[model samples]
Target: MKRLLCLAVAAASIPVSAEDRTLEHVLVSVPIHRQESNSVLPVTVITSEELQRSVATTIGETLENRAGLANSSFGPGVGRPVIRGQQGPRAITLQNNTSSADVSSFSPDHAVTVEPLLAKSIEVLRGPSTLLYGGGAIGGIVNVIDNRIPRERIEGIEGAAEYRYDYAPDLNSGVGVLEAGFGNLAFHLSGTSRSTSDLRIPGRAIDEAALAEQEEMMGHDEEHEGEDHEGEEHGEEEINNSKGKIANTDTDTDVITAGFSFHFDEKGSYAGFAVNNLNNKYGIPPGAHEHGHEEEHGEHEGEEHEGEDHEEEEHEGEEHEGEDHEGEEEEEEIVRIDMDQTRYDAMVHLYEPMDSIEVVRGFLTYTDYEHKELEGSEVGTRFKRDTWETRLEVVHNALLGTEGVVGLQAKSDTFEAVGEEGFIPKTDSTELGLFLIEDFHRNEWTYEAGLRGEYVERDPSTNAASNEDFTNWSASLSALWQFDDNWQTGVSLARSARAPSTEELFSNVDAMDPEELVTHAATGIIEVGDPDLDNETSLNADLALQWHSANSWAELSVFYNQFNDYIFLRNSGEEVDETAVYDYLQEDAKFYGVEFESSFHLTDLGPGALALDLRGDAIRGDFKDNGDVPRLPPVRVGARLSWTGDAFGTWVSVLNAGDQDRPGDFETDTDGYTRLDLGADYRFSFAQERELLVFIKWKNITDEEIRLSTSFLRNYAPEAGQSVAAGIRFSF
Candidate 1:
């Protein structure tokens, strides 16, 4: 396979850009693996330079602008990527094709382990080829590619370090990395740290009266009992203030990775092993409070009550009563939430080409992740999981005038929740699957088809009482046609399925009360009947077109996805009459949308080249009377203008969100607003091998009080207002 790829490379006569030359000539290059012939799949590639140029804090935030992607944020510190509107366990996150081993499925507060700053490139595989991954990848796959281990035998060492700071939004961040190679051995390591204070709006903060009006228009009362009462009082006073500061919104992260590879020159193959450990300590947003109501009566009340009691028990010194009162006040329960997480992952990869036929590749990985949350009165749920995966594939050549590929994979996972009482029962899951892919191409037309057969088993350890086993199949077909060097069109149809995770099955604990009115409920209070949950299946179809001309690029896509037995947590109005009570249930759902994006370069400018980019998405979907999947984002459109030159680059973008009427049983409609972001960078050469990038960014330029549909705190806490940030990056 390596020789074939080499031959193809040598035979090609395409002009290579300077960036491409640097990657292929200076850095070790690996064969660009192509999906088997006749398979209809689409993969989007994001270069490292793109990541560097984006003013994003997390991997999910960086990709949110991409087509067909969305992000759910837990304040500014955490975010999860959503592909085609599907998230959680259904979307697999990979670091070099291995699971990230994080608790992303359990909640939105947890951060992914992959460091966006350290990544070399990001690959998003859509369509059928996702079956090559585990069954969890029903949505798609996000692979964070990095050069931690040597891809080829080398003889020396190389490393780079960077530091960045942004002042407008009050942010400071830095990273350090090192890599070394000796003969066939290599290693890489990196660390990053960041901190930010309250983010300010771009202009004058929204007037308190305006906020009240907006809330009222959205069917939300400004003075609901135990709901934003303080804001209401402040509004009554005619005081205009900035949005609440993002408390504990700082972050400290560290990562260490190392690997060793052995080059087999005779066999034209390389075998390697790698391990990564990530530790992060970040702030969780503050929960909303009901007015200025103190949890306690007051010091005067306690003293007065103590005095009365002392009079009654004059013989029993008052000192004892005073001490008791103080203790009681100090011990009053006040919810203070915080989170800590750690992940460890190890993987092994082997590549070898057979003397005849095709090349064979094998991969095995083991991952362990632990997450813990601390909150007053809450059960403080903790989850730990261990997963093992192995895959073997055989790439076939066109011996019979047809090219194709076949693969087999098996995965086992153990998920356990300790200290959750009886709410979340420990679970063990195992899955096995076999897949085949065939790719065929003739002139300007390409076609592909693939299918996968899978078996899954789930068991509850606490009570040998509940267990389940099921078999499922997934398939997809796609076709792409190129009309010219600058135009291409494609269509795809696929069937996908997702099994339930432990959290969806038995999570029975009070996670947290973001809104003060909602008290905690027993985990899985709604209950799970029969333990025999069927798989959620979906049929999806999409049509896409791409046009790339000399200085311009554009893409448009339309898609529809229908699901059978879509699993959702429904607001069971009964809820023991409990506020914010929701039950897990299954129902049918359908989602359809169209997205368009385009970019045009205005080269006839002054000192720098100018470009305009526009993108938008409109989606409408419904779930069986479940009140329109709560937290589904609203239709949004955005446009950006950028200028790049030898020493300076800058970009400004405006985003607008449409109103959302979809509501959960206990949910309310959300108003929409517009925001603006502007950023600029200046480059300077410091030395022969060092450079610097000084940048500044302003977000929410209009100071619009925008509310994101994907936010859990939308009821009481609004999204952050506009703010400015400036930073410098020094590289060596």
Candidate 2:
């Protein structure tokens, strides 16, 4: 701890003027379009340059360094962001202000479809501003903005291409984009391809401590198996455990997008459409337990020979053939997911549409998405979702010294799952929402208020499940005060409600019969849902202070949320068919957290301008009636030092995660870990106008073992070890 503080202090003495200024002026697009500093909410915007430098295969990995964010990784291919100790359905992911339309929220092993490399800018919004998207966004929102719609007209043709390689995973990735404009019409095309081998780790793939605990328990159980010789001792079994590399962690992905837009009315009103297709094949690391078929086959065989058939089955050739076939199938299968999505989007924006409206915007999107979970050569389960969504907003002119936006959003989707792990039946879901927001400005204060109402309905195809509907509403109010020349403070309060999701209400497991129970292969648990689940609601409060000067900027925020009928999945202390049982239940819960981020610019101590960036975040969550919330992220703190010149830049950063001693029920503790990384880049002009840039990065130089508390696969697969990544880009 002392060494970490010393490094932070030394790094804090440097300065970077250019980057600080750029961050101050960046605009955030969610809720409303406004400058980051001018808004009453907590917002973080990653510009194109910053995004290019830190882009990763998953959105969670790309933004994990930011304050208040953690990556809950399933493997190298799947990472979902956990915000302020909230994840899954609580934190919403968007693409250009629209839903990404993926089933990532349904399970931790599923991957988000958004590609960070293709984004022009990424915006993160927290606090009351999240109400504009959905009341369910109690945690936060992530929106990836791309140029596929072409909001502005370009005069000429421009394009860029880049390639990157990483040594640890033998990853090779490339991206290309091209844009052309002819008068009022513009065309855009882009593509990206990424492929990686199995992830490499520093030591054994499995956590030995966790494995030992399991074996010890098993040994105790085995000791009482034989009453005739209860005093006899047994030897431990010798198992072959893989080392250095995590098997079945490879991934391959490809994306293609084409768009065209036509600008008219003096470039004020433009309509455009874009088409995108994505295909990905990724592996699940061993121990994820994709054995839905194996369990069923074993149970059926056991039931068939329960009585006098035991002796007959032992002598039957057909029974032996059946056993051999099942063995072959098990040996030939490796669990993986093959996913694809085709999306179409259209948008139109109008300025000064009427006397009372300053701007009007409309968006329409249709998506066809499907993913098949493969158990070796055969598909274990196939999940499909077809969705269409539309939204319209009118920015009304100032009235009574207030300005705001009124919006309407509607979405519909049909979701289906087939084959062995299909716990939830086919369901059709529909949602409609109406929202209003108003902003009032004063000499030293800015006040904003918003209200939203929504209707959600789910209808299942099977008669065993009935239709469910909900009416939900939310409200928020916030005020920002500029108390001093370099200091500002904000206070916000909100009440948000979220309706139950399809899976939360419709997971079908026959509790009466163990053999008939449904098990989710990805999680290795029998999950049962309640049909009478109520809406989950929360009351949130936030306070923030920000200070800025010529050479420094800092922000501190604290938030608390109290929930009524919080929805959570919990183990029921029951086992059926040799699998644990989990049920979706509601209980009162509370979460609170603090986050601090600061950057200091100092005089050039060497050949280039220097700056220091420091960030830290901590969160705690627990149920009011009982124990701590499960899988909460540990406290984290980090620091970075960077030096930049006209053509060259270099940076070093260190992040440390505190020990997670408060692991929830049935969870194991995770030790603390510190990671260090360094990178350098150079850019120069060539061919009179074109530019070429080269960069190199060394990640996890210390090669520490990192087991994320928020990850379901933490005990089986640690993060990648020491690796070197290099890339080059050429633009014209």
Kindly list the per-residue Cα lDDT of model 2 for residues 1-732, writing each as its tens digit.
232232221111112234655456455364354577778778866777776677888988887767777788888999888777777778878888788999887878889999999998888786534457775576788888898888788779988999999988889999999999999998999999999988888886667566444334334235434443212311211112346787778999999999988988783788999999999999887655531111110011111111111111122222121121144423443578999999999989887867888778888999999999887777878989999989888888788999988999899999887887688888999999999989898999989899999999999887776789999999999899999998999999999988888777887632456676777765556767788899988899999998988778888888989989987776564656656566678888888877777877866766677887888777777887667776677777778888888789999888888888776544567888888899999998887469888999999998888888777777778899999999998888
Range of the 10 consecutive residues with the lowest summed lDDT in candidate 2: 296-305
Q: How much lDDT does each candidate structure score?
A: 0.57, 0.75
Among these predicted structures, which one has the highest lDDT?
Answer: 2
Query: Where does candidate 2 stray beyond 4 Å?
Result: 1-20, 23-28, 31-33, 128-130, 214-240, 290-333, 509-512, 605-607, 687-689
RMSD of 1: 10.9
Task: Tell me the tens digit of each residue's lDDT in model 1 across 687-713.
Answer: 655677777777667767765565544
Q: How close is candidate 2 to the true structure, as a TM-score?
A: 0.90
Model 1: lDDT of residue 358: 59
